[model samples]
Target: MKERIVVKIGSNVLTRKDGTLDVTRMSALVDQVAELHKEGIEVILVSSGAVASGKTELKIKDKLDTISARQLYSAVGQAKLINRYYDLFHQHRIVCGQVLATKEDFATRRHYLNQRNCMTVMLDNNVIPIVNENDTISVNELMFTDNDELSGLVAAMMGSHKLIILSNIDGIFDGDPNKSQSKVIREIDTQKDQIEEFIQSSKSTAGRGGMQTKYNIARKVAEEGIEVIIANGRKDNILIHLLKDKETLCTRFIPSTKGVSSVKKWIAHSEGFTKGEIHINEGAKDALLGEKAISLLPVGVTKVTGNFETDDIVRIIDESGKQIGIGRTSYNSQKANEIIGKNNKKAIIHYDYLYIEK
Candidate 1:
């Protein structure tokens, strides 16, 4: 099997000190991707440089709202961005396609599968797919946390063997980057609980994600049996070194041996898009969270809130309204409410469709 890898270029890595797009850096990264292409490695590039590209040439006369400015900038920048990629790949005698995605694209099973098929066909034809968020159309509260989150989704959806998140800094550190005592943590095994304390929550104004989001996305992607690497893209030939060298200065998240089902993987990323809430009793919560896989029965459901249709995504909550997981519901909100707290009924969410927090 051709090793499929997803590479996410962060805004910090693609943006120069002047906050403009770094054309030289961008070309260098594409060169490495082309190198990987020659070796028959299927690559998906999730890039973030549209806003910076917009800053390079355009100047707005009137002050605009944050969303409006972003929309305007993305509209102009995405065009220039893809054209550059198209030209660069063409120079290498490689064909590359652009895929602009929104959060809604992965909200449902059908949409998710449709995208997966499109990219699968592209890979089968040996075409590199350069993906980016549709920032021009994405609405507030509906947008992704950042491209890091998007890359993780794409990696899982495509069943990629590895996910490489490139940023400006080296990787997660024991202390602040400015401090002399800080050092890059080389490898992250299954000790995610111990690593949580090191992730700082401060976000960046440019890309909306920081080290914390990268770590969260890395952890989630690794849990899905995909190895994840967080490395400094500013360093020349970083991607090439990661594959060639035995030791690279990157934070590697070791993947889990257990495999996750396709439907469940889609459900895992649908936590933010659930249409309704299914509040279950303590018994059902315990059973679902237990080692043995258990379906969510209607008898354990105390309440069904919101207006969702059959097969829609729904969130499973505990008595205190804490989210336990998300799943594809077998019943609509009306029917689910009708059968709540009853016995010998059909499951509200089957085990196959349920994705619980680990």
Candidate 2:
């Protein structure tokens, strides 16, 4: 099988400092991806710049509120962005397809499978799938945290070998970026490092995500056994350089040794789509994380937080409210509540449908 990778280009990388679309930069990225394609590596791109592009075209001098302006700008910008990609890819005789996804699309098994199949078909035909959020329609619950989160889900969904996140900065720094003598961390071992303390909470002017967001998504994808690289997008031939291991200053996240199943990957990345949460006791937590694979029984559930139907994705939290895992329930919340503390041999969540977080 050919190696597959998902490359995410942030808004900061796609646009100029003045918040305008940088056609030259976009062209360069396309060229790098085209070269990778010729080398037999399947590449999927998740790009963010619609709002920035739309703002430049619309030139809205006065602020028209956050949500309304975002809707207007994204609706107009998405077309321009996709058209630009079409033109750029066409120059190299490479066919590319645009995919605009919403959070609700991954809420159900059917919708999730449908989207996955579409991308699979495109890949099977040697077509590059260019993905972006359906920003015009997404709001509140229907929206993703940012494109970083979306790209992580896409990488997990497609079972990609690696996920490369491109931003303006080099990578995660040991200290503040503004501070002198702060150095970029070349590698991150999620299991050992307390990376959160080093990340800044500030968002970029051209993008919704910050350093913290990238770190989080990188860790999540790496836990699923997908290698992740966070690098500076502004550098020339950054994509090609990283792939060739050409001495680049970037943070490489080492993938876990144990590989997760496709269904479990879906459950792990679908926390946003959870209908409810199940609070499990300490014993249940230990059992699920034990050496032997175990199913979640109703007796282990101490409290049910919200209403959800059977087969709905739910968060599995410990008694202290820390989320330990996620799973699809075989019984509804009401039924599970009724059977709590009772001897029910049937598994509320089978091992196959459960994902334990590391």
**TM-score between candidate 1 and the true structure:** 0.97
Pick by lDDT: which candidate is best? Answer: 2
Q: Tens-digit lDDT track for model 2 on 22-59?
A: 98999999999999999999999999999988988886
Backbone clash tally for model 1?
0
lDDT of 1 by residue, 161-241 (tens): 999999988888988877899988888886444687787677765688999889988988888899999999999999999
C-alpha RMSD (angstroms) for model 1:
1.3
Q: What is the Cα-based TM-score of model 2?
A: 0.97
Task: Candidate 2: list runs displaced more than 4 Å.
Answer: 61-63
